[model samples]
Target: MKTTFEFLNQLTKNNNREWFQSNRAKYEDSYNEMILFADQLIEEMNKHDVIETSVGKKSLFRIYRDVRFSKDKAPYKTHWAGTLRRAGANRRGGYYFKISNEESFAMGGFFGPNAQDLLHFRNQIALDADPLRNVIESNDFKNDFGELLGEKLKTAPKGFDKTHPDIDLLRHKQYIIRHDFTLKQVHDPNFPEIMSEAFRKMRPFLDCMTEMITTDLNGIPLV
Candidate 1:
């Protein structure tokens, strides 16, 4: 794990193709270490939520960076990332892990839902804010993850009044809970357990969003 962190720390400084190809062995070693961790994490996650082994593979993000649309043309990413999504659920939401020498975090929620899904998410909030609020406000959830973090509309979202009690919640474009960790913490043998507990505590939040996005009430998806 420490070696992995060293590789990424150096990669952050030298992100070009020539340097990367020269150090391909190091990258491969680091990537394999990450994959092993992901595999273990998937197993732990399955104990709480049904996640396919294939999801572990799908979860491990590619290290290459798509430089076509970006101003920064670095050929590779400085950090490794993975996601664990529900086995049969749509890809709109999942638990994500990103680690670098400098920083790392565990996070999950609905990110970039389509217009219809986003609308339904808001509608879900309007209809039953208690479930969502209760999860976010619980001491365990609050202590682990400070607040629900995401982009918000400057004003109220359409069909939602500004004065609504849960206006701030409805204005969100994404709903996520995140907890940052240091390199020291990630290097600990208990890191996987730490991550599992974090995800376990967040079960309600994941369930709330998953239900909203996947369930159909009447003809339309609830979220």
Candidate 2:
């Protein structure tokens, strides 16, 4: 990780096509190391969670940036990131990691849910917020995630009562929980175990969300 971090840190100071092309060999070495680490990370991850995406190499995001829509057009990204999908139709969340000089973090949950799925979440909360609330408000969840975090609307979403007791939950446009790690932690020898355990802490929230998003308000399986 020191090598990986050094490469990325240097890239930040020299963020141009010429510099990346000149350092291609170094970049490949760092990239391969990241892949190896990710592979180990996934193996440990499957111990406590079911991951549909098995190979770490395939899970990694491309280092190249999509510059067409962006104003700042750096040819390559300054970080390494990957995402892991939960296995099967019943499992309904993702696990992600972003490694960079700025900060490193791991996260798990649903993001950008479709309208129907969002409605399902709101309906479940409106029906009885306890089950969902119980998970997020628990000691384990708080100790790791602090609190539920995601994009939310200031006002209640359409067709939902603004004054409802659970309106806070209803206004969510996305649902996720995250754990940040220091650069030292990211570079730790036991990082694979540490990273995997951080994700393991997310099961209570993820399981509750899987139930909410994959079922009708009456608890009928949607899929």
Candidate 3:
């Protein structure tokens, strides 16, 4: 079984469509191998009795990068991303981890326009400063994101200062957690285990956010 790191490294070096077409066998083999890895991750989470809403569904594995709106458009991407979803779930989102030399990380979240629903979400976290602090100051969160996100969190929009009473509150409001790691070290034999460990460790925060947003009519937290 090829590790995720290997699959991603191969992808980065062979990014073009023609390259992919010529090496179709490698792509297919890697895709199937990743599916198995994802399955093992699901099973491992299940063993720990994690609360997951999506399972036993088709996961997509593709090399195409849709850059219709981007200024620096690239015909293709030298990376791989995939997701697993469940049927009949209005709150549909999935976990995705991207592998590339430039930007590589595991991220899972829902995206939406700046509608009333989203505005309400922003207001919810903005209003209740304490609960938001509870989330940010929690030991688990500190361990997972404190080092990586400290600088970003410290410098919010112009209006909000880090020392502001609501600064920590705003930190958890309508934001995304995108943590990066060193790619060279991520290819080691222990990389998959480390990645899985990080995901599992952050599961509680993901679950808590999901539970909080479940009562909302237009929001669904990603895990």
Candidate with top lDDT is 2
Model 3 spans > 4 angstroms off: 1-14, 49-57, 71-73, 84-94, 109-117, 147-173, 179-193, 215-223
Candidate 1 structure quality by residue, lDDT tens digits, 1-223: 7778889989999988899899999998998888888888888888877775464566888999888999998888989888887666542467888888768899988767778889988887887788788889989888889999988899999788999999989999989889888767899987877787777777788877777767664436533
lDDT value, residue 186 of candidate 3: 56
What are the lDDT figures for the candidates, one per model? 0.82, 0.90, 0.52
What C-alpha root-mean-square deviation, in Å, does candidate 3 show against the real structure?
Answer: 5.9
lDDT of 1 at 9: 86
Clashes of each: 0, 0, 0
List of clashing residue pairs for candidate 1:
none
Q: Compute each candidate's TM-score over C-alphas.
A: 0.89, 0.96, 0.64
Candidate 1 structure, TM-score to reference: 0.89
RMSD of each: 2.7, 1.2, 5.9
Error of 3 at 76 (Å): 2.6
**lDDT (10s digit) by residue, model 3, range 1-223:** 3444465566676556686678777766767766665666566545543425344224445556778888745556666555533233333324556665567676544333234434444455554545545765787777666621312233554444556566544544244444455766455555545555655665554544444454453344433
TM-score of 2: 0.96
Worst 10 residues of 3 by lDDT: 84-93
Q: Name the lDDT value of residue 107 in candidate 2.
A: 92
Candidate of highest TM-score:
2
